[model samples]
Target: MSDEKESVVGASLISEDRNGVRTLTLHRPQRKNAIDRALWVALRDALDAAGHDPAVRVLVITGAGGAFCSGADIAEPDPTHPVDKMRRLTDVALLLHELPIPTIAKVNGVAVGAGWNLALGCDLVVATPESRFSQIFARRGLSVDLGGSWLLPKLVGLQQAKRLALLTEMIDAEQARALNLVTWVVPESEVDEFVLELAARLVAGPPVALAQTKALLNEGADRTLRDALASEARAQAVNFATADAAEAFAAFAEKRDPEFTGRWSVSGRAVPL
Candidate 1:
């Protein structure tokens, strides 16, 4: 881990890497960490870098202030054409979803509109008890964008997704959890510590297997039963070929804890997490 934190675009975003976990923080506290054009570009670049960085076993997204993202910064004028802006936003969302390593969204406060959808792009979402969420596009007189139309239904089912999008009602973290939009709802004071521990656990797991599992699950919903089964079998085969699989068997036979060295781009060897 580096001693200094890297600031992205004058601290509108920040990046820190520690113990195989790379955390990207939305840093616009004065604006409730809203997404401006610069911040979006910085986030996209960070995710792309993390995806290719073998040392990064997990990526965590959060906001720096007491609040998470409130949504897009509507006050800021976008110089870029609307079409190009949407394209960039789409690219960022896809980059986040397709990143090889696991991604977690740590929602500490309000996450509304595009901010909520951005959190949904992550593999897991943890929110504080006081965190509030809403799909507020309708209230803004704009239809849902940033892949919310696809992700919301997959998360909370079609009817509930409609209810949330249509009504644009704010829900507490507990309610979000009940609706399956949030993975866990913990106290605000413990969110950072809890996310750190969770990231450590994920980092300690077999990297190849974990990545394969994430890919499989992400694709499962769009595939037919037979297709999903075939994909699973193929993923299992790939996992079995990794050195970690043999290590696991050996440890099982010897009755000891198996140390997983998350092998990434390294050739002919495994390295410690």
Candidate 2:
């Protein structure tokens, strides 16, 4: 594996800062951090590191200067070879969804085209008040790519997702919040701090329970009612076996703060308590 520091130096999409948060900053700030080949490779590596790194409790993806991302750089591709281009770009969003760690999209300004789906791929989204968004592929004579078609419907239901996808109009943060497009909308100055606070909280929480919750939620979404209930029971089975679960209840009984001892490792072994 490349040294983390060295990787950071070369990466354009994925960058790590002081906090435990792994930031995937869209590097094309001039073109609103539009996606490119190097950015995609760097992003995959960054996300892979964070997924396996125990230190990272949260992953934040945002734009550099203003806009979060403007999606793929159409100018880079030759119009004569349109084959497999959409699938390749869509893989980035898939990578986002497949990340093991909790992910958040900090939309500072606008997210267009695949950029919008990139935000959607994260587990949650928090946008600045000034942020605006649109699924603009249609406006460019292209249909939505990546997870937009599937994610939008799941996020805001069929009707609203249709309206947004079909019209390809801009939706401000306020409108996004009202439509359940984002978790929160704060001032631009507060976006970083707010996201940090959330990351810290996750870091401090019981790693076992937090990971279990995230896993269960992601998997539970696709299960049938009976299957989902079974999945929940299975999760609880694992959850109940954790030291954190025992510590949590014991602390409650003693009316003292729980000092959790659990590792986020996929390994079932508990941390030495």
What are the lDDT figures for the candidates, one per model? 0.88, 0.76
Per-residue accuracy of model 1 over 1-273 as CA lDDT, tens digit each: 533355564458888888889989899999999999989888888888899988889999999777789988888998899898898789889999999899999998899999999999999999998899999998888899889999999988999999999999999998999989999998888888999999999988899999999999999989999999999989877776677877887798899988787543324544332
TM-score against truth, every candidate? 0.93, 0.87
Task: Name the lDDT value of residue 164 in candidate 2.
Answer: 93
Q: Which stretches of candidate 2 lie over 4 Å from their true place?
A: 1-11, 17-19, 78-84, 264-273
Task: Please give the lDDT score for candidate 1.
Answer: 0.88
Give the candidate number with the greatest lDDT.
Answer: 1
In model 1, the clashing pairs are none
